[model samples]
Structures are given as C-alpha cells and as structure tokens.
Target: MPLAGLFAGALGAAIAPFALRLRGPYLAIVSLGLVYIGIYAARNLPALTGGLNGTVVTAPVAIGPVDFAALQVGPFLLTREQGMFILCWGILALVLC
Candidate 1:
C-alpha cells in the first residue's frame, strides 16, 4: 500500500505539468476522464488488473514464527480479523512515527 501511494505521488508529480497547462473546465474534464480511463484499462487488461475476474493476493503475513493468517501465540490462536487489526494499527503507528 505504501509503494502504491508512492507510485501515485510520483504519477501525480509527473502529470502535474501537463495538467497545469489546462485551465478551468478542461482541467476538470481531464481529471474526471482519468477515472473512466482507469476503469477502461482495468476492464480491458486481464493480464494486468485481472479484468472482471479480479486477482487474488497469495502473500503470507508473518513475524518470526507467527503466521498472521494462522496466528498462534502459546495456546491462543488469532483470527484473520485480529491479524488485520494488528497489521493496520502497526502500519498506522509506523506512519505516525
């Protein structure tokens, strides 16, 4: 998600010059068109965005011996929601710090 945010920032920076060249309604139209363009690309590109079927994320979330997907701490087992809660808060804290 951080990488995606960075990529979006980089993309905005690169496009800023061209977008600035447009004034008033033209700029608004172009900004609105970007959404449609993204939808079109996602719908058309199966190999890229997985098209209508969508893609699955197979990555594992782990820290040392604890796999967050199947988290076990001593006799206690954590659920997926618990893992995500921990992950999200950890990321938020990291960003804040």
Candidate 2:
C-alpha cells in the first residue's frame, strides 16, 4: 500500500541524522553495503520479495481520467513502453522546470 512508502519515508527521515554523519568513501561504502543488504534480503525473503526472479507489481495505472494502461493522445494509442517513456520524461521535465 502507499502507506508503506510513507513509512519508508519517515524511516529515512529518522535515519538521516545518523546516515549524514559519514563522509567521503565511508558514505559510499555504507550506501553500497545497504544496496547489497537489500539485494540479499530480496533473494532470501521469497515470501516478501518473490526472491531473485522478482514479481509482478500491478499498481493502478490511472490518475483521474488519464489511464496509463491504455494511454491515448489524439488518434494514437500508446503501448506500455511508450506510455512509460512519456511519463518518465514528463516527470523529469516537471522536476527540471
């Protein structure tokens, strides 16, 4: 659920004070170690993460009237890849602006 993301965000905020203490290569090493730990957890925790094979994430594809699962612009209907491309770039452009 989206609440999980909020929890993660709160966890990160709480951990920032400790994580920000490290500098230079220490920070890099810690970040890399966290990545490895996540990978290891995902691989070992099959029930939670679906293991190394990964799992399908079927989240909602619509926001209001815009349905990304079947995105249409004018007369053209976009494929999933095309929709994703547009969505990603749109986000990027919005951030940049």
Candidate 3:
C-alpha cells in the first residue's frame, strides 16, 4: 500500500490549485481550519478513522524470500520487531540516498 506517499502527493496537488487563489494569513487560517476539521472527523467517524482510538494492523512483513515474521539468516535470527526495525531504517537509508 503506497498510502503515505499517495496522501502526501495528493495533498500537495490538492493544495496547489487553492494556493494560487489564497495568500498570507487567509491561507494560513484556511489550512489550520482544514487540519482541525480533519482531526474532528477522525475523532467522530468510528468506522472511517477508527474513532481516534486507532486501528489494529495485521499486515505481514515480507520482502521476496525474506519474511520478517520469522527471519533467520545463518546464525542470526530476528523477531518481528527487530526485522521491521531493520526494514524501516533500511528503507529510510535507501530513500535518503
């Protein structure tokens, strides 16, 4: 799921058109209002945004033959947390480069 990147790109594109029509404090207030509205919706909409308590994730962590759920390499074995920690930082490093 390209969820994070997708939302970020879409938000940029969505705001760009409006940005041309807004300026200074007017734009700032509008942006702040939108953020407050978004937060309110997340809090009130139970099914949509998990009602602020948040949602449980049950996604598997895997990359080709490397399954993070039960990762083992020669003499090294890693737990789910350890595997995901490596994967996340590794991806961050790759993106930074």
Candidate 4:
C-alpha cells in the first residue's frame, strides 16, 4: 500500500510539468475525474478495501508480553488502531524521506 502511494505520487509528480499546460475548467475536470476514479476503484475492490463494511487488519505489534488481542487501552482498546497508526505514519515518513 505504501509503495502504491509512492508510485502514485511519483506519477503525479511526473504529470505536474504537463498539468500547467491545461487551463481553467479543463484542468479542474481532469483532476476531479481522476479523484473520482480512484475513489470508485477503492470502493469496488472488496478484497483489497473491504468496501463500506470496512476491513480487518491484524496488530502490527504485541502489547508488551501479552497477546495483542487480549490487551485493552482506555475505552476503545483495539490493536488494529495502533497498527493503522503505525502503518500510516510509517508511510508518511517514507514519503517525507
């Protein structure tokens, strides 16, 4: 997923030089269409995205010596959230780097 985002960003960067050639409504329409298509693709790929029902992601790390599934944190205790946060931040850092 992180790699895919990186590729997309690279593609966008490559296209940026040409984007300036487009003007006004033409540029807006093209950009909006791309956004719509990306959203549509994500929604349709059930195995990849799990659609509106959402998807299950396992823990990125165990909570100390305990099993991550058995661990609790505050009221909304879940390993998935921690995993996602780590995943997102890791990707963000990769992008920044």
Q: Provide TM-scores for the models.
A: 0.51, 0.55, 0.48, 0.44
Candidate 2 lDDT tens digits, 1-97: 7987997689779867878999999888978887887789888999987778855757766668887878999999998778777878888999999
- List ranges where model 4 is wrong by over 4 Å: 55-97
Across 1-97, the per-residue lDDT of candidate 4 in tens digits comes to: 9998997999799878878799999899879987987789788986876676865655345545744444465675666556556556766999999
Error of 4 at 13 (Å): 3.0
Alpha-carbon local distance difference test for all models: 0.83, 0.82, 0.84, 0.73
What would the per-residue lDDT of candidate 3 be over residues 17-81, giving only the tens digit for each residue? 88769889989998888789888988888896668676566799999988987888679998888
Q: Weakest 10 consecutive residues, lDDT, candidate 2? A: 54-63
Q: Candidate 3 vs candidate 4: which has greater TM-score?
A: 3
**How accurate locally is residue 92 in candidate 1, as Cα lDDT from 0 to 100?**
100
In model 3, pairs of residues that clash are: none
Candidate 2 Cα outliers beyond 4 Å, as residue runs:
2-20, 53-78
| Candidate 4, position 86, lDDT | 59
- Candidate 3 error regions (>4 Å): 1-19, 64-82
Model 3 TM-score relative to the real fold: 0.48
Model 1 per-residue lDDT at 76:
84
**Residue 3 in model 1: shift from native, Å?**
15
lDDT of 3: 0.84
Cα lDDT of model 1 overall? 0.83
